[model samples]
Target: MTSAPAARASMDAGRALPPPVLVVSIVSSYLLALHPGTLPRDATTTAVVTSGFAAVGAVVGMLLSRWASRRRPHPDTQTRRVVFGAGVLIAAGGAGLSVWWQSLIRAAVGAPPVGPDWWVAATVAPAAAVAAIVLIPRVTAVIAASAVALAAGLLAPADAGADRGQPSPRTIVVSEFGTLLRGELAAPEFDHPAERLVRSWMHSGGLAARAVIVAVPTGSGWVDQAAVAGFVDRFDGDVRILTLPYADVPSWKAFISDDATATESSITLVRELAKVLANRPAGDRPRLVLYGQSLGAVGADAARVWLEDHHPSLLAETVLTAPPAGTVAQASRTPRIVVANRSDPVVRWSLGSLWRPPAYPDDTVLGGRRVPEVPWLPVVGFLQSSVDLLAALDGPTGVGHRYGTEQARPVSGLPR
Candidate 1:
């Protein structure tokens, strides 16, 4: 029979092997799932691929566990060390292969590559290292080193298809503000005042002849900067763009409290915008066009409501991209467009309910119990890509819920 120390050593060697195998299996499973070719072309295909990955992971994990338990004891420490070192190498190789494969897959799919998140790798590495130490006999040092190397590689920042080239025109001016002002002015495109006035008043009220674009900065404010530049480049008009800072809700709470003032700053900015437009000459009769994303979307919606209630004749169009929860319905009636992405994890959370129940009239809600189909997916994708390009220019985390290189398309006829 094998002695206690011999058996213990054997068990450790076996343990080391299983961890590498587990890492390989996990990385393989994720890559398989992410392969563009396997992505569900239809609802049925998606369900199949998702289920397949889950099942494979479960089966592989079980098998690895059983295999690791069956190894026999060996008295040679060098042999055990060799086996442990091999396992570490295998695990690191598997991780490296996974990353390389994913990059290739992304390129093949014509989609942007998945950039590395150091934070995620940092959290994953230590667990992997511990597993290596416990499983491999006499090879704990090698396993730890391999784990660190793998983690470092995985966590290293990568190019996310962001360097397509510099923007042709680097700045934009968003001019329409309040309810009656209508028009957009960009670096490359200039809006005709008469045409803008007609378009601004075409919908709800005939009183306002022009609209102003209000830029409300949220979070880091990079989005506001990029959006203004993009608008100026693409839009052909003389619309005015006003830059406004995010408002603090606590300060505004003393004035208005019945409603949750989560986006009080945005509301305050819109209210101030109306006052500014009112002071303009008669020809500049103010109409409003609001553009907001993520948290700013929520603020823009509140501002839209405030505009409609106070200056009914001045309301125009509202475009919200990837807005947070509780902001969709605010743009329901007016010429409103919402852009959302299916792959975006954050947007996925809010996809369940675009509008809250009770207040959502039966006619306005689409698809009944299931979430309504977002009519602006294409636009969202374009805007997302544009934001990505902008991020590359600015050298920051532009992929996360911000304005990027994605172009915003017109969604005029789609059902909300």
Candidate 2:
């Protein structure tokens, strides 16, 4: 079913890349793209500037393709060369259309204009074009597939609207793993999963822990067991965790417009916990802690008002990780800890929340990693944030948008 030339070309293109080359290029490309600040206020003007950058990239890609073909005279190389040229052509057209498209959205919807700094994205146009010409042809397929997926995600119908949302639930989903962590003094005294909770007793032979935690699942509807392993093992005494089940989907897309789903589930969890907290005597009452990660973090944070209004109780603390944009109005008043990696893009897209410099509050903690320092370009940085987001999801924590570093370790508020 394959042609000789096509088969040969596939083999040449699919050769395994060295880890170092792969790591360096990805980091370089992402950092070069992320110089966000002070974008042009006019969306049209920003697009025009971005278009200018694409023109520059076309010329650069052509030159690189010609140079690479001469140095490596092979049919496969020639094919890549052609593909790179085509990519440039497509990119130029797309840039022009993207500007026009944004304009239409503004004209029709009365939405805010795209930021002026977004135009700076054009600066990386040339570099990205050249990389395609000289480096990985494999990435081409990924980009193409992503284009299709984006369309599908955007086209999906909207969920529960602002005025009314889905009804509340009577039962919640609870999961149990024998130990969230292994090693060093984690003994279960009153181990129970049937009540939809997990309780771990201290290794020092304590009867029970004096505190409890109720954590919501991530946007994807499951907990990152490893990330929470430390929380389970850190307590000096018994710690109880109650988790809700909204396992219908594994992505934030599942909850985008569905505020009610998050509100209802979180409300149910809090209400049920309040009943247990109400019954206990003061000395025996476990200190309540609220926790959420990623999408779960946003939902848990936002639902604070409703929880307080209806189930009002003093929570000892709320801990969140990789929380997406918490609008200025959604900012929390309670003492809570937010952990975010400087490289994560989900936080960046929120405009002012996690990673970008001008947006964080004085109390926020940022973990630094090396990023190629390029000139600060707002528009370009905005454009680059999308790429960095992908890389962060697939690449490194502190370096790309991913999280999982020692710096992010659970500290004193949790058990030792």
Tens-place lDDT digits, model 2, residues 181-250:
1111111211122123321222322224555566666533455554455465555425655555443443
Q: Write the residue-wise lDDT of candidate 1 on 1-416 in tens digits.
A: 99999999877766444344444554455334333321112233223333344335434754674576477442245544555466556545644654554455344334355455422342244344344433462486565468669978885332222212312122332234332232222211222322343344334343343335654434323234455545444343324444333322321131133223325555655665565465656555644567766555666667777777786555566666655434456435556666543323233333333332212211121110111122334233333223222222122223233344232333366221
Candidate 2 global CA lDDT score = 0.47
Q: Name the regions of candidate 1 deviating beyond 4 angstroms.
A: 1-105, 108-130, 136-210, 233-237, 247-262, 275-284, 309-312, 325-327, 341-343, 349-416
Q: Could you tell me how far off, in angstroms, the CA of residue 361 lies in candidate 2 after the best superposition? A: 5.1
Best by lDDT: 2
Looking at model 2, report the run of 10 residues with the lowest lDDT sum: 181-190
